[model samples]
Target: MPAAGRLLAERHKDHRKRHPLLPAEYEDEQLAVVEVTALWESESASGAVLLEDSELTGYVLGAPKPSPVWGPNLWVEAAGQAVREPEHIRDLYAAAAAKWVDDGRTVQYVVVPDDADLLDAWFRSGFGAQHAHAVRPAPTTRLEPPAGLKVRRALRDDIAVLAELDLVLPKYQSRSPVFSAGELPTLEEALADWEESIDDQDYATFVAEYDGRVIGMSVGCSVEKSSAHSGLARPDNAGFLGYAAVLPEARGHGAGRALGEAVMQWSADTGYTAVVADWRVTNLLASRTWPRLGFQQTFHRLHRAIGY
Candidate 1:
């Protein structure tokens, strides 16, 4: 735990320069130090640190989470190297992963989208790219739907349609090496979530209707800086856009574009300055669409599964 803060300060400064597309997190150093200190002090987490002549050279920390939906219930919460001393990355990551293996954790998750060396280090430890987080400033443009299409807030009657589109993400991920269709929520589950979202003031669900039939859908909700799980975001008011999808027959129209624009405009009008969303790296439709919507790649959520 000692000197970890100092190491993080140097790493954070360099990370910002290398990943200008990511939102600022100047407080990450302090927050990381606090989190690591708490975990270390808890006596429940395991960590590995490489030292050179009694100075911290590199470090990796792991702790168990309450859930393990992604496989290994353990998480590599923090990892970094001192300025200009990246040689120990592989060893450090390996050491931490070894602890997970001993602790019966076969799957490990870590976010290192912007850190190539760190990502390489994790790759050496058996991790691979899983998901991506993207963000952009909320737009003020008043979006217009395609000919004969209309965009509106989804009502209770729209849950069935929205739930179907929600399956699109899982379907896309199911075709990739990093995911399984089983991970996606079932129609019942998706409908339940939509139903609950209706009561949440901070949440919004939008749909594009053509000829009175829902052809596309999008969902967004607010997340404060301190509540963000992705450390790539700045400590500012932000919103998350998700469940965005257009029916196969509706793709050529403007359903996807209109839904996206409306959600972003709603975010802006709701007083949020930035909006964040993510897609699997292999999700071609999302990969191409989000970028054109003005979102920039920010963080990559990488994963590795052992014995599965």
Candidate 2:
């Protein structure tokens, strides 16, 4: 585990060098060791390690998620891999995939750092980008809301409207390029969820209003509260922009951006140094908007399925 941690620490350093905005805490060797050990010791863990001259050079591991959106899937978590050479990952995956497939886990996903050569290696291994995690410094200034639109922290009174707005993103994803088949939460479920979140001190919900009607919404919370952002990609003292959606009629306007800015401002005021968010790679609007808002891609979730 110590050797694996050393390799991971080096990989993280390389990532930070290439993307200066990345958080520095992950480069800590001890933290990397602990994270790798947790995955390596999991009951269902399956992996491969490369050794040269009796020294560890690379490793890959994966385990099944408790309940995944995809069937019988294994996730190669953010801390699940490190390699001395980019091409060595191909060999690691080949060994790991055989064990995983024999276990009936045909669908697989891996969270990988944002490096062209590394991504190219994964691409050659039959993986393609499915989702992305990104981060940026919290903005110091509040962004101006779109003309005639008011952006403010959400209140209990906005629960019904928030529930309606919540369906917008999933609805959009159900059509066209994304075509996500995940079940959409009912309005009652959304309402119940928002009711809890609105009063939760750890959560901050923001809404964009036009003519006294809510047209968009965004939610922010500590990174520690989000399973996706709280793992290997998490930064120290960071906040997560967990959810955001805008009405169809409000599309052309800057309501989404306004709500996003409001989240960033909330994160900044709440003492977070950085903010992180993630989106489906095929969600056209989200894929484009998040990067445009200054969120730099840090890790990409790549996926591949065999005999599905």
Candidate 3:
């Protein structure tokens, strides 16, 4: 475990050397040690450790997700892997995949740092980019919304519209190329969620209105509140832009970009230094919008499915 932690620390150090904006706190080996130990001790844990000359060179571990959305899925979480050499990752994954497939976990996902060599190695192991987690410095000024468009905090009266806009993302993902099979939330579910979050101290919801009709919405919260991002290294006092969607008719009017800027401005006003967001890599609109908004990729979720 200690050797694996050391390897992870070294890898993070190298990543920081290339991308200095990444959080520096993770360079501590003990943090990796604790993280690796917890994953190793998890009930569903399955893994492989590579040893050369009685010395640990690399390791890979994963556990099956209970979520029905991901049937027979094995998730190699952010801290689930480390290696002394980028090429060593292929060998570690080869060993881990055999055990995972034999156990009937045919769909696998791994969260890997945004290192070119590391990503290439995983690609060679038959994984392709599936999702991305990214961050950008909070903006001091909000971008101006398009003419006749008003952006403001969401209200109870906007719940129906907010709920309607929320479905835009998942519905789009279900179409060609993306093919995200996760069940879509009903309007009732989305309305209930917004009602609970509307006045919550931890959440901030924004809406874009055109001709007094809500056409887009966005939500922001602390990074600590996001399970997908909390496990990874992030800038101190980072906020998360958790959700954003605009109606199809509002697409070219700059509603999406305006909502993003509003979220960044909110993060800045709320004392956050940076803001993080994630999206499916194959979601064409999001894949292009996020990077253009100055969010640099920090990690990639690579996926591979066997026999299905």
Candidate 4:
């Protein structure tokens, strides 16, 4: 296994398949994948650090729990790379695996039916099949909320309010940080820069207001994969109801559901045939709400860590 990533680039094909939408800068970001690995190495998430060779030619990433110790994740040198030496690679992951099993820990796994071979390898290696992650389908057509909360297209001025709401919601500390506090666009800033995001097509956000405040929101985007048809080979036509949040005070009043329903209708009316929304495993409200509005529970992406 000699520097195969550069010499036999094709061997890294599995990694590419694992992350198809990986931007050109696959290795960098504020929450860069590289930094995630390094930061969690000793944290709960680092299950075990295995090196293909004692020289550290290849390694694995995993985070063990307790304190959600090192961020639990895994990575290795590109498969075809020179570090693919069987004994070394096995020993490397084996060390981590031993620690994981002995520690009485479990890791979460997300897989597609088509990745049978990969799943086989994973299970054979002791990765248990956790509960399948689920998503909700967007409304197939546009439909209004119960008609009193005032559903309207979001205005430039509303970004601040919505951005404000974004600030107060519970921060789901998952492996991938899609909604960090700093990532939120301020109202005034988002207003001035609204034009920049509009041209992306199939991008729109709706809001529900009561007493002059942006009480609830329903934002949709076409960039995500849908729950109905997941294979990459399938045609892409669905969108995701990216943001559907309601203030706590508005919960039982049906504001959350209204906002969500309105967004599904908007998507359906706007030509999107499907809508998908992601909810953390612990969000009892979302887990229950979407299914009530014909948003069939689809799949989930779990977060786990290793360590005590």
Candidate 5:
């Protein structure tokens, strides 16, 4: 389509509009057009381009294996451009989803948070917000623990306690309408995850203690710049934060804050320049807490499930 470049340009422009603080790279639409067009050269990629009087009005490209988080389904790997024009977006998705559904795919995921019109189109086509990724510079704050508590790297024996903290996230999300409800992981699953983290040299796990009782936990690890989308994090020397939580009874006691500081401390000590993390938007506590700790929203993962 002659208008493909322009449509993709609109996508980049819309993204930068949604995130005003985004780095200057996002302002370069030509680069975005190059990246998006390259996906279409893949053999498995498929999509539709709508035209009104021979001008591209909308387009979508779907591909398998774009990510593991969305399960075994076709991801809307790249899509945008004139989507908000009446039924254009819904029609494009309808055409794309029909083929995937017939081929036995059951889910579709797309990342498009910065465009209100595009998001509205997605909502009209059955998509809902699922995840939010946030980032910030490695903090230098002098976070000291409360008088009765201390924070330090968690030992292997502390695996069980860290697993308990991991459960809080699922429990919190289960009650929030905006997040998918699901069964809590078994203790075995939680332990296995923590064990993998502990064994990885690049990862660090921390816990907060009060009178020798563990009250909170956090995990930090190196992140691959190439694996993350452009502009989501700095292009180099980045880190990723995993689960972090403090027990309900320990809310105001500084255990959570201390644990967070420990993660940032680990990032700095390990030579990382910035860190990334994600939390559900509907979880009221996290919605308030993460921003307060300086994590700025970078991208939103939108989900749509048309039952098989």
Candidate 6:
């Protein structure tokens, strides 16, 4: 990529007004523009495209490499007036898919149904929104590390133990809501990736050891771009407080609080103006901890099921 010619701040502002789902911040400015006008860059890219040459009625965003994202790992996002020419659309999509297949990413994320031009075009285009995920903002406001638990920076030796601990403690809780549940089939794969994440420069992994036992753990991954209300730009180790988990026995011992506060202090000491974390509206811990840490729900994105 030579250079992303345009400034994202301009596009970001416009997208915010039009599509609230678009993240308010851009971690990589060049990446944002490259992603935005992927339709125009299709010739240079290996990915297929869904385009409209006449009337310039439609637009698509595609990438040679698929980003790690939740919504079908999307690289193409497009919506526009009808692309009525019809003949070119299929080739466009096929080209894009071929590009993605051959590209290293080995995945293609596209917006579904191609509602603007043709439904079958979308079906033929080979794109589906099988399961949708939302990228809501995580809390960036710092909360002090709680007392009573010893907090310290993580080490490589700690990863194996952390990996096993992470597998269960804060495991997906949907099934019980009151108890921990099964790991998704792909969870181990995600865990494999976290091996690299344990050493990522953007984050800090801190553990709270109670009586020499690592009862609780908290991980903070920094965000280059953030949507916190503070509107500060480019804070280092601007921690994204995640992987906050506590053992069952340590549940009420203020372990979570201690781990959380430690991360906050580190964020403060490291000179970040804020940190970010999130919880489902239904999660009880979020209901308590967020408020206790002076966090407030800035916005709500409601989920709805359709075509059932």
TM-score of 4: 0.52
Please, what are the lDDT tens digits per residue for candidate 4 over residues 180-229?
22244455664455545534455677788776667877777663533423
What's the lDDT of the predicted structure labeled candidate 4?
0.48
Q: Is candidate 3 or candidate 5 better by TM-score?
A: 3
**True lDDT of residue 258, candidate 2:** 85
Residue-level lDDT of model 6, residues 1-308, one tens digit each, is 21221333333444355334344554355655554454445544333333234223233346433323332222443321113344455666554455444544445444332123444555555443332222222335545445566778877767655665675444545444534233343456646866777788777788877777777678765654334312212223345566577776668778777777776667666765556555654456755775576543332322222123
TM-score of 5: 0.75
Better of 2 and 5 by TM-score: 2
Show model 5 residue runs off by greater than 4 Å: 1-10, 13-34, 41-44, 52-57, 64-72, 78-88, 101-106, 145-148, 171-184, 192-199, 225-236
Q: What lDDT score is found at residue 121 in candidate 4?
A: 43
The alpha-carbon deviation from the true structure for residue 51 of candidate 2, after best TM-score superposition, in angstroms, is 1.7
Q: Write down the worst ten-residue block by lDDT for model 1.
A: 226-235
Worst 10 residues of 2 by lDDT: 17-26
lDDT of 1 by residue, 198-253 (tens): 66776788889988899888888775522334443442577777668887777877
Q: Provide C-alpha RMSD values for all models, in order.
A: 3.2, 1.5, 1.5, 10.2, 4.2, 9.5
Off by over 4 Å in 6: 1-147, 178-197, 225-238
Which candidate wins on lDDT?
2
223-304: candidate 2 lDDT, tens digit per residue = 8988887555888788889999999987867888888888888889889989999999999999988899999999999998
> Candidate 3 vs candidate 4: which has greater TM-score?
3
lDDT of 3 by residue, 1-308 (tens): 89988888888888777556667766799987888888888878999999999999899989987988887899988888888888989999988899899999999999999888889999999899999989888887756676888999998998889889989999999997899998888989988988887788788989988888888988888988888885545656888899999998877777888888888888999999899989999999999998999999888999998894
Taking the tens digit of each residue's C-alpha lDDT, what string does model 5 give over 1-308?
A: 33565666665566556544444453355655665676677657777878778767777777776455556677664333335374577898888777788876667777664556667778888877866777777766655666888898889999888888888778767774645555678878988998876767766888899888998888877766234445322324667776688887777777776777778778877887777767777777767777787877766667766773
Candidate 1 root-mean-square deviation in Å:
3.2
- Of the candidates numbered 1 and 6, which has the greater TM-score value? 1
Candidate number that wins on TM-score, 4 or 6: 4
Which residue ranges in model 1 land beyond 4 Å of their true spot?
A: 18-29, 39-43, 78-84, 140-143, 146-148, 176-178, 181-184, 225-235
TM-score of each: 0.83, 0.95, 0.95, 0.52, 0.75, 0.49
